[model samples]
Structures are given as C-alpha cells and as structure tokens.
Target: MKRSFVALMAFTLLIAIIGFSAHLVVLEINDTHGHAWPYGNYGGFAAIATIVNQVRSEAQANGWDFLFLHAGDVNTGVPESDMLYARPDILALDMMGLNAMTIGNHEFDHPWSVLSRQMAWADFPFLSANIVYKGTDKTVGQPYLIENFPDLKVAILGLTTKTTEYIGNPEYVKGYDFLSPDEVAQKYVPMLQKMVGPDGIVIALTHLGIFGYSEQTVAGTPGAVETAEKLDPPNNPYGGSVSLAQSVSGIAAIFDGHSHTAVTSPFNVNGTLIVQAGSYSKYIARLDLIVENGHVATYTYKLITVSKDIKPNEAIQDLLTAYQIVGSGKLNEPIGYSKVNFANEKDSTRKADTLIGHLITDAVAWKFKDMGVQAVLMNGGGIRAPIPAGTITYKTVLTVLPFGNTVVILKIKGSDLLKAIQWGGVYHPEDTGARLNEWGLTYTVTPNGVENILLDGKPIDPDAIYTVATNDYMANGGDNYSMLKNAQQYNTGYVLADVVKEYIEHISPIESYPFTPRWTEVK
Candidate 1:
C-alpha cells in the first residue's frame, strides 16, 4: 500500500512540475507602414511600446520570459516616415527596443547604400536566411539569431520574400541574389535543433506573404493544386509562410508578414502553428507557449489591438511628438479635397479599374500637355497607397506616389503601344510590371485578347508613330516593359509626386475624376 501511494505522489509531482516548467511570450508586429502616430485613435508606436512593456512586465512577474519581434516592412507608407528617408520610423522603432526583425521586400525599395545605412542604424539584427551577398555565399543580414533564457532557449531564422527581387525596386536589388526559403530552412532548422536540443523551440520569422492579395477570379489564370512538399518557392510556394510550416518539421510557430492580414488564431498545419499580426502598428500579436521536455505542450495566440485605451509610453510618445511636429507641419498642409476614397491599389488595380490610378495617370498626362504627348502610361507597380475621401495633404500625395520617379516622354510605334497595353493586361491575378494604368487611351482586355485599342478616342493605327508620356522606371524597361527600352526618350525634370502635388493644388476641391471603364478586364 505504501509503495503504491509513493508512486502516485511521484506522478502528481511530475504533473505539477510539467505544468509550471516554463512560460514564453512571443510578441510580434509586422507591416507597420510607418504609422508612428495615432490616426483617430488607431495605431501609434507609443501604444505599441506600451503593450510590449506591459506584456514583458507581466511575463516577468509570472516567472516567465518575453521576446519582442517585428516581422518586416517597417516603413514606406506615411510621408512623415518616408520623406525623411524613413528616419522617423527607424528611430522610433529603435527606441521601442525591438529584439529582432526580418527583412521585408520593401526594405529594398531604397538604394543599396541607404539599405546598408539603415541596417547599421538598427539596434537589432535584420534577419534574412536566404538573401546572399552578390557573387558571395555570405548572408546579407543575420541569417539566424539565438536567444537564451534561464529556462529555455529560442532559435529564430529569418527569410525575406523572394518577390523582393522583382516587387522591390529592381535597381536597388541588382547585386543580391535571394535564395529559396525552403532550401535555407532545410539546412538551418536541423542545425538549430541540434544546438538547442529537444527542449528548445525553433521559429521562422519570415516576411513572405501568408496568401496572395487578390482572390477575385483572374481570367486566364492557372487553377492547379499546389503544395509545399511537391513545389518549391520557385514553383509557387503558395504563400511561403503556410507552405513552409506544412513542409518543414521542428518549427514551433511562424511569425509572418507582408500580407497585412490580422491572423488571430494559431493556425495548425501538419504540427506547426502559424500566426501573423495585422499591419500599421495597429496590433501586437502575442503568442504564448508552455514548453516542457523541449516541446510545446500548450499554446495560445492573442492579437492585442493598440487602441486609445492603452496609455502611451511616455518616452516614446515624446520622441514621436518631435517628429510629428516637423513632418505633419510639412505633410499636413492641405493641398486639396477629394470626392472619393482613393483606395489602396491592391484588389481593384490587380483585376479592374481604380480611381487612384486614373488620377495619377491623368496628372502625368496633364503635366506633359504642352509636349504634345498623345497619352500617359503609368505602371501600376508605381502606385503605392490610396487616398481616403477627404482633405488631401502633401503627405497624401507622397504616400500615394512614394517612389521618386520622374516623367520621361517616349516615342513608340502604335503597334508597340498596343503591346504595352497588352503587356499590362496579360498578368491579371498575378501582379507584374505589365499592369499599365493609362490616361488619354482606352482598351478592352479579356482572357481571349486585346481589342478596341483607342488613342484620343480614335482607333490606334498600328504603324503610326506616337509620343507617349511614361515614368522613367518603365522607360528604362522596369517590370519587363521591354518595348520602351530603345524609344526616343524626352526627359522631363518634374518629379512624379511633385507633379501630382501641383495638379492637386492647382485644382482644389478636386472632384473624383470619374473612373470610366477605360481599362476593362473582362473576367
């Protein structure tokens, strides 16, 4: 009887110890497009600091540990952030005390020199396991980082989206070759596991998108069943985060970004849990894990909204105040008022028409009116964010047309013009340089073919030569618009954003330029 009682007591003791062994809090924020200050009570870096500090304190009080991580895309949306070369955003994040972050595709939007400077400025390592320096095997950023706590050890491996090569400024990423995340994972995951042993947890902090942005039926698009086990990142990893979690083992969870989707729950696939916090400094994703015997015994995911109710961190708030005083004074000067919400060029531009695109193209056309340019062709890739319905600011203009592209007029054969329109329409569903949004021209594009090519409301003569206004990027054959490579280029010194600013200020109370179905994609 005593033997059985002692055995039962030992079993109960084991249960108690297992339940109280270790508590780990993983805090994540991603896709924070430079929203350092609150906009109508939503999103601010001060609030994020408040939440992080609160969570960290709470975890410590409970005899647990915490990690603060940012996924990617830290800047490039707000004028306050971008105009100063993302300095405000970078400084704010550095002060917020982030443990580490992965490199997003947008990080490559600036010059390589600028990227190098930002990497140096950061307090934490910018992680990217797959990105290798040009002509060398060295990883550009910290391929992986290890953190040791009293009770547990954590291994973090970072991977940038392969799309960074194309989606980012082509010129900026010319030297670096981004390797496959899957191949990188196969090598690193095992090495990490061997180092940490069974009790440690391995995590993939990746900037690869969770899903394709558009779900609208794209005509002439493929519908084949793809899986991570069979297909590589090159063959369509179908949202690299989900794909890798399904295929790779030993990864406890994936903290992901680039899609801006608020993933609240722990999505279990094949044994791994994948989660992503929403974007724009709006929410802090808290992933809690109870680790024992080198395995996650229990886990929970929480998306803590950065609402106004949470008191802002005083120090961080003060720093942001100084930045806002300068940036807002410059950016907030009301240029005009808009009659409509200039939507983000995500879903609408991918398949159909968007007023924001029209406004930009129209501005470009009007800017070169004296030059006798028959039409304006603005590459959809250049349109960054959308304008909300209301008072428009210079900041709004900057955010809408962030890239500092200048106007360059080109002379192209009418046949090549048709090809330009066809090129933009060809990659429907899949975003590419070919998605040309234009003004002073109209065309109907279906999966079958292009038709009704009109220039100045007249049928385009395939052989007639025409002067066309386009951005310098496209004229240089960015996004595979190869036809314009050898065109007679007429350089216009006007910056695209400045042109847009002039157009808006020139016409106050700017009415919603009626979005006629100029570029129709028949699904």
Candidate 2:
C-alpha cells in the first residue's frame, strides 16, 4: 500500500508541472487614427479583429494566455471617426477586449471637459502616471493597473511625453504637473512590487514617442544615446521596475507611441524588449512571454501588418457603419466646392496658394480681424495636406489640419516680427540647402545669402509694432521657432477649421481654379 501511494503522488506532481508551463501572448495597437476600415489591403477594425481572434484561438488551444493593449491616439484621422466623436472606434476597441491604454496629447485636443467625459466611457482603464492634476498633487489618471490572467499577474503603467506644449492647450495641462518617466518609476514601482511580489510582470505603456531615450529624435537618429547608455540602473531597494527596460530591475517590456514612426523590430534597451505597433493601426505588435517559476524566462516579439490575410470582425464593422450613417449627414454635406486643382508637393517650400492653405489662412485672418489682427503667417508644415478638389466636406477639413490648433493674434513690435522671420529662415540645419514654404510676405536674401528682414518690400525695424496672426504652436516655439515666444498673445477661440468652414460658406464653390502663387521670391 505504501509503494502504491508514492507512485501515485509522483504521477500527480508530473501532471502539475506540465500544466504550469503556460505562455502568454500580448498583442497591442497604437495611433489608430480612427481607421475602423483598412486603407488599401492593409488594416481596418475588421481585419485587425480577425487577427486578434485567430491569435486568441491559437493561444487557447495551446493553453496560453492572450491580452490586447493600445497606446492611445485612436481618433481624428478619417471623417467617419472624427465626426462621430470617436465612439465607433472606441466601441470596436472594447469588443477586441483592449485591457488598458494611455491618453495621448491628441486626446486633449478637443476640450478638457470633453476629455473627462470620454474617460467615463472606456471599458478598460485609461492610465497616466506622469500627468498631474491642477491644484493638487494627484496625477491626472489611473497611475497603474494590473491585469490578471489565471496565474499570470501583468502590470501596465501609462506615461505621456514630458513636452506637453507641442500637442495641446498648455492651459489644459495647467495646474497639473508632469513627472518624468524615471521619477514615476522610482516613486511607484517599489510600492507596487511589494504588494504583487516577484511573479508579476510590469510594462510601461507610453505615448512618449518611439525612441527610448530623450536623445532619440523623431528621425530615428541618436539624440541622447551616450547619456542613456551611461545611466545606471534605477536604484530601487525593493527591486522595483524602473529601468529603461535595459537595466530596469523588473520591467519586461515598454510599448511606446507618439512619433508617428514605426519600429519594425523590438528594440533591446538593456536586456528588456521594447515594441511599438506603428501609427494609424497600420500594424500590430505581438510579444510572447514564457513564464517559469513566476518570472519571464524567455520572450519573442514580432510586428504584424493589418493586411488582407485576416478577415475583419463583422461586429466592429457594423458599429462603424451605424456611426457613419449619422456622420454622413453632417460630414458629407458639401459646404463649398473648389474648381481649381490643388496638390501638396512633398518637396515644395512655397506652400502658399494651395486651396486648403489659402482657405485656412483666409479663415485665420477673418476670424481674428475683429481683434486688430492685420496679417497672418501660417506655417507650411502645419498645412498637413492639400484640399483635393473633387469633394470638400467637413471630414476634409479634419484630415487636412488634424490638430485642433486655435488661432492666436499677436501684438508685436516690428523688430519682433523680423526676429520671427529670421527664426523661420534658420529653423533647421537643412534650411539653407532646401526651400521651406513661404506665403503672402516676401523677404530679400542678403549678400550673405541669409534670410534678411523685410515686410511689404521694406527692411523691417525691430522696435516697430505689428499685428500678426499665427497659431498657438508657433507662439509656443514649436518646431524650433523660438522668436515668437515673447510676443504679446491674444486668444482667438475660433478654430482654424471653423474659420475655413466660414470662408467656404462665404465663397461657395468656385467653377474654375482661382488660386495663384502668393509666394514671392527674394529679389
């Protein structure tokens, strides 16, 4: 009897060991841009859903776990998604069982109150450990959340970029402070790890751009490479998750977004795996974690394009269709028609006179005319795309200028205006070799071949006063245009898109292309 009992116990132990060898597959998407339907043969909500379902089914068959995550910035690309207030896209995400997401700066491009309201609708928690709430020490979001799958304990912490000025209304983030990623890790990881113990897996879900360090510029060039490499592992006595993943104690991965760039492969910071699923829902990232003894023993990462191989989920398509039915009424209305053919050339510096640019600048000057604004200087880079002549609708406006950038009227001395012009001339190192967009105003290139000062064909004096119309972006020195930072600012609540809409209403549709070059070459 004793011999039989020993043999039975050994058999049970062997079975348990096999059962515990379960693996986890984490799939994530970022910067969907409200594309519920795939563009070309690539992704849409339906096609992505098909991929998710397949991954889940296979994982289940193998006794593995599956999870879905997003890095935010879901709305504002297409007319259907933007006009419907992002409901269709959010509904689709909920159906896909998205566990958690970080709030991107674009999320606040609407209004502060609207952002709070939208957060209420999310099925999964919206997280951000770094954004501070105004007038209090508390953070602006759920700092961290743990998603438990059977025996697996997965912790996801959310973070936004520290540079808030580039994305939204600075006042929107006013009263709220932002903590650095390192600071956040130092503060929270210790306490969380003590509670969850060593078996828990921690991931930082960030909208802080694709590059890992501060020096990782948008163009994928090394920005802070040497500095990042020399930084020591985060000193957390409790063995917390704080490293940049390379040397961070317990962190397993980092999923990043915001640069609108794609990382085709997983980036290894130290020994940690970092992945981003490009923007516009163009791709999905798949990461597999093999856990043993309550820790990640091994891992693998792959990026899957949301292409034709997978079938889109029908349910998501139906939801989008229902929303589109409503949006079609408002978005598809032909506010005005354009008779001229407008094209946005990739290599053009004179972005002036394109139908969309003209319509936008005209709107700006018109909106702020009541506030003593005489001229407008719209940045060419801000003009994302041209107005395709065939059908100009509400949706068209949103895609053309996605950032809900408000127009600000500036009261500045003539010298200040000259400085602004000079700043634009040398904004980037590549400026001299390439021509950037110029509009309305013309300047003379000095014998030095530098952009010298001029306005209305005369040399600009620094102390003379001028009324200028520009967007809040330039006012805050975005894109390295720092000269406008000191100009007296006047708030014009009128949105650039709304201004365009009014211009369209006033002009109606033209029968022939009426636009001509407004840019003047330096004589």
Candidate 3:
C-alpha cells in the first residue's frame, strides 16, 4: 500500500511539471525585397522596427522569449537599395536586430562577389541547408541556428526552394547545387531532434513558398501545403516546406516565404504550424505560442499590416533617409509623363497582354530596330511594377526593370520561336511569371499549342530565320525558356532600365502605344 502511494505521488509531480507553461513570441517578415522605405503608407524598415521593438520590450518585461526573423529575399526591388548593393537594407535590418534570415533565390541574382560582400555586411547569419558548393558537402552559409531559452532550446533550420537553380540567374548560381529540401530535411531533422532533446522544439525557416500544386500547375513546384501533404508526382515534383513537415517528424512550426502569400491564420499540417508573411514588408506575422512540457500547447497568430498608424522608429528612419537622399537626387528627377496608367499587376501581365507589356516590348523593339530585330519578347515576371499615370522618373523605370539584365538579340528558326511561344502560353488563363509579353508579333493560344503565329502581321515561315530581341536572362535560358539558349545571340550590353528610360524620354508625353491583342486564348 505504501509503495503504491509513492508511485501516485511521483506521477502527480510529473503532471505538475508538464503543466508548467512558458510563453514565446516570434515575429517574422518574408520577402522584403528591399522596400526599406514605406510606399502607399505600408511597410518600411523603420515602421517594422517600431513594432518589433515594442514586442521585444513586452516579452522582456514578461519574462517571455522573443525572436525576430526574416524569411529572405532582402535584395533587389528598389533602386535606392539595389544601387547600393542592398547596403541600406542590410544595415537597417541589422539595426532592427534581425536574429536570422534565409538565403532566398533572388540573393543569387548578382555575382558571387556581390553576394559575398552582402553576407559580410549583415549582422545575422544567412541560413540554407540545401545550398551546397557543387560536388561538395560544404554549405554556403549556416544551415540552422540554435537559440537557448531558460525553459527549452529552439532549433531553426533554413531551406531554400530547389527551383532556385532555374529561377535564379544561372551564371551566378552555377557553383552551387540546390538539393531537394525534403531529402536534406530527412537527413538533418532527426539529428536536430536528438541534439535538442525530446522537449526542445525544431522549427523550419524556409523560402520554399506555400502555394499548393494547383496554383503552380505548370511549374510543378509544390508549395508548403502540397509538400506537407506529400502530394504525388506532377503535383509535388519539387519538394517544399510542407513536404519537409510530413517527411520529417520533429518540426514544431515552419516560417516560409517565396510565394508571397499572406497567411492570416497558421496552417496546421501534420501537426506542424506553418506561416508566411506576404512579400514587400507589407505585413509582419506575429505568432504567440504557449509551450508546456517541451511541446507547443496553444498558439495564436496575427498578420500585422505595416500601416501608417504605426510610427516609424526614428533611428532606422534616419539611417534609411541618408541612403534615400543620396539615391533620390538622381532617381527622382522627372524623366517623362504618362497620360494613362500602364498596369503591370502580376495576374494581369501573366494572364493577358497589357499596356505596360506592350510599352516595354515596344521599347526593346525600337532600340534594336536598326539591327533588324523583328520582334521583342519580355517575360511577364520581369515587369515588376505598374506605371501610374503621372510624372515618370528614373526611379519608376528602375522599379519596373530592376534586374539589370541587358538586351540580347537572337537569330532563331521560326519553328523554335513557335516552341518558345507555346511554352510561354502553356499556363494561359493562369498566372505564371514565364509568360512572354511580345511586340511586333501576334499569336493564338490553343489547347494543344500556339496557332496563328505572325511576325509583323505576316504568317511566320517555319524554315526561315527570324531576329528576335529579348533580355539576357531569357537568352541564357532563364524562366525555363531553353529553346533560345543555343540560338545565335548578340548581347547589346545596354541595361534594360536605361533603354526604357531613354524610350520614355524620347516619347515623353507617353500618351499611348499599340494595345492590340498580342495573344488570344481560344477554348
């Protein structure tokens, strides 16, 4: 009887220990894309810092653990940040006390020299477990970071999308191998679990995206949901955060980027909570978790909009202001004016021909008209933003074309061009970045393939060679357009933004341009 009573007392003690709760607050931002300054009264490093600081202070006062994380893509998108090699953005993040960040695909947009320099400038480590030097096990950056709290330890692992190999600049990422995230996670997660012990939590910080197979039908890249569910072939051709969650067993939650999704409520997949804040620093995701007996017992999530109501942090604002002033002087100079808005919204540009698409392609066609370039093709994804009707500045032009890609003229047989057009229109009616925007050509998108192919109003002759102008990205097989890779090529060495700027200046009062349907879909 005495021994039984002792066992009961011990079990009661265990239950008490398990019931003890610890509070943890995590703030995450993904795909900032160098919008350090607020636009349209939403998002800015200064404003983001203010909210982060407040949360950090509150957590400190309450004896709760706090973490501030960025999911990646800190480079590109803004002229002020891009011209300075994202110095201001990195400095501002450092000042904001960012704990860690993932290495996004866009990080590979420039040469290794630029990325290496940017890495050296940041205070926090850039994490990616699957990105390894070619033919070696060596990683480009820290794979995961371990943070210790009074009650438990947290393991944060970083995984980038395998699509980086193709979507990222091929020239720059040639030295690295983007391994499948699921394979890497399966290998490392168990090790992380053992290191953290049973009670500790393992979290995935990824740039793998959250869209499911249906959303990315053509690309066959699975999102967090598809990955988590482990959808079969054609749906989840490439693994994602979701796959990691299902394939591996130790992860408590996942913070992801890449799809630019605004996950208002956390997605609970295979007992793992997944969250992603929309891109461009427009939203900050706050996750408050209650940990008990080494597991997440309860949680709440909110995607905080970086509205103007939130006052900007003075210190961060001052730092960004200096850089902004330097670039603003040249970028803000009025270059031209537009009578009507040239819409470049992602869905509009990718699904159908738009005015902005026509304007950009027309500019390219105009620049190389003397070179006998018959038509120009620009990837819909390349048109980053819209040009609202008003004064157009160099900044506006740069914002639209931020990749610094030069123009390339290719000589290809009409048959090859048809393949390229068909590939571009394969995902018609559905938004895809690979869709081609054309000038000086028109075609019909049929269920089977492209038809009515015409160049300058004449039916294209399959055996004839045609001169086509496109960006260096496409000429080198970017966006999976491999048809043009082997074609005869001439690199013009002119920055696309500068070309567009010159065109805008020459056509100043930019009243209108050809808006004819470049491609029509026939169901």
lDDT of 2 by residue, 1-523 (tens): 9999999999889866753444889898887877786676775888888889899999999878888888878766776776656778887888888888888766765667767766777788888887887556687778888877777777788877665533344446544666566667656766666655556677778776533332122221233333333342443221112234543456667787765546555655655566677777778889898976556688877788888667668888787778778777877777777766556664132322355556677677666667766567766656655677766887677667666777777888776676666555432421221122333456544434446445555666677777888877667665445566778887677677777777777776756645655443343
Q: Which ranges of candidate 2 are over 4 A from the true structure?
A: 1-22, 212-243, 338-341, 344-359, 366-374, 379-382, 422-439, 443-450, 472-493, 504-523
Deviating ranges (above 4 Å) for candidate 3 = 1-20, 212-237, 428-431
TM-score of 3: 0.92
Pick by lDDT: which candidate is best? 3
TM-score of each: 0.86, 0.80, 0.92
**Poorest lDDT segment (10 consecutive residues) of candidate 1:** 216-225
User: Pairing residues by index, what is the TM-score of model 1?
Assistant: 0.86
Per-residue lDDT for 1-523 in model 1, tens only?
Answer: 9999999999999876764357889999898877888876685888888888888889989988788899999867777777766777777778877889899988876887777888888888999988998889899899999999988889999988886765666567778988878778888999999887767889889997555432211111122113322332333433477667666788988898877767656556557776777788888889999888778889877888899778888888888888778767878889898777878655455445678788888888787888898998887767877788899888888877777788999988888887877777655443443577888887887778777778889998888889999887777666767687667888787889999999877876867566677766676
For model 3, what is the alpha-carbon lDDT of residue 466?
94
Best by TM-score: 3
- Per-residue alpha-carbon lDDT of candidate 3 for residues 355-427, written as tens digits (9 for 90 to 100): 8888888889888899999989888878888988999999999998899999999999888887888788656
Please give the distance, in angstroms, between residue 315's alpha carbon in candidate 2 and its true position after superposition. 1.5
